[model samples]
Target: MTAFPLLLLALAILSEVTATVCLRMASAGGGRWWIGVVAGYLTAFTLLAAVLAQGMALGVAYGIWAAAGVALTAVISRLVFKEPLTWVMSLGLVLIVGGVLLIETGAAH
Candidate 1:
């Protein structure tokens, strides 16, 4: 029960990150690639709703998903788009991960 919602939340976030990457790629002359971006976002939101439908608490699920999404999207941006990554960015990602962990742990209680 819990695992299912969490899985869907993670998938939603990942899809969102993928969508953002695809959007950036499209903007950089990857013609018609925006379609992928649009589709990704659509899928992300749909999956997000499914997570909620599975009984995930809205605050916990949404917060964790957003934080994880931002961290992962940044990582993907650096890897797939060759975007610059600084020490600050790495530190920020770590903090985001930590924060998300804390939130999830709290929610468990």
Candidate 2:
């Protein structure tokens, strides 16, 4: 993938991860936290659309986006919320990364 679309995809992943984290925070903290959730998701979707418009295949783009989001969210949540990050979970993350890499590479064929 080109740098621009990849950059947009990265941003989209970050936005989605941030939004998911905000959602959890909002559940506990309430109030203005909801704004972060909304803004983050909006930004994420917008960037995702831009990535698609850049001619990225949906399967590849979404695979990368979702896998990265899940991994980042899990790690971030563990750091921020003291949530568990067990060995099994870590293995799953590694597997997810591998899977996304496969999807991305296969898309080139």
Candidate 3:
């Protein structure tokens, strides 16, 4: 994919991750934070839609999106929430990244 579409996908993943983090914080009676949650998800979906308009296949785009979102969310969760990151989880993240790379490369062919 071209840089612009990839950028959109990255933005989508970041937006989703942000929304998830906000939701976690909002769980403690911070109802106002739900606005952020809504905005983030909406922004992400919009960007993802734009990416699809660019002709990226669903399997490749969504596979990369989901993998990056999960890995980034886990790392950020550890930093922001004092969540523990076991070695196994680290391995899982690496595997997720590797799998996404494989999907990306396969899509290029």
Q: Which candidate gets the maximum TM-score versus the true structure?
A: 2
Q: All candidates' lDDT scores?
A: 0.85, 0.94, 0.91
- Tens digits of per-residue lDDT, candidate 3, 6-95, equal 999999999999999989989978998899899999999999999999989888889989998988889999998989889999998899
Query: What is the lDDT ranking, best to worst?
Result: 2, 3, 1
Can you list the residue pairs that collide in candidate 1? none
Global Cα lDDT for candidate 3: 0.91
TM-score to native of every candidate shown: 0.86, 0.96, 0.93
Instruction: Flag regions of model 3 displaced more than 4 Å.
Output: none
For candidate 1, lDDT tens digit of each residue in 16-66?
988888888898899888998999999999999999888887877888888
TM-score winner between 2 and 3, please give it. Answer: 2
Best by lDDT: 2
Quote model 2's TM-score. 0.96
Q: How close is candidate 3 to the true structure, as a TM-score?
A: 0.93
Per-model RMSD to reference: 1.6, 0.8, 1.1
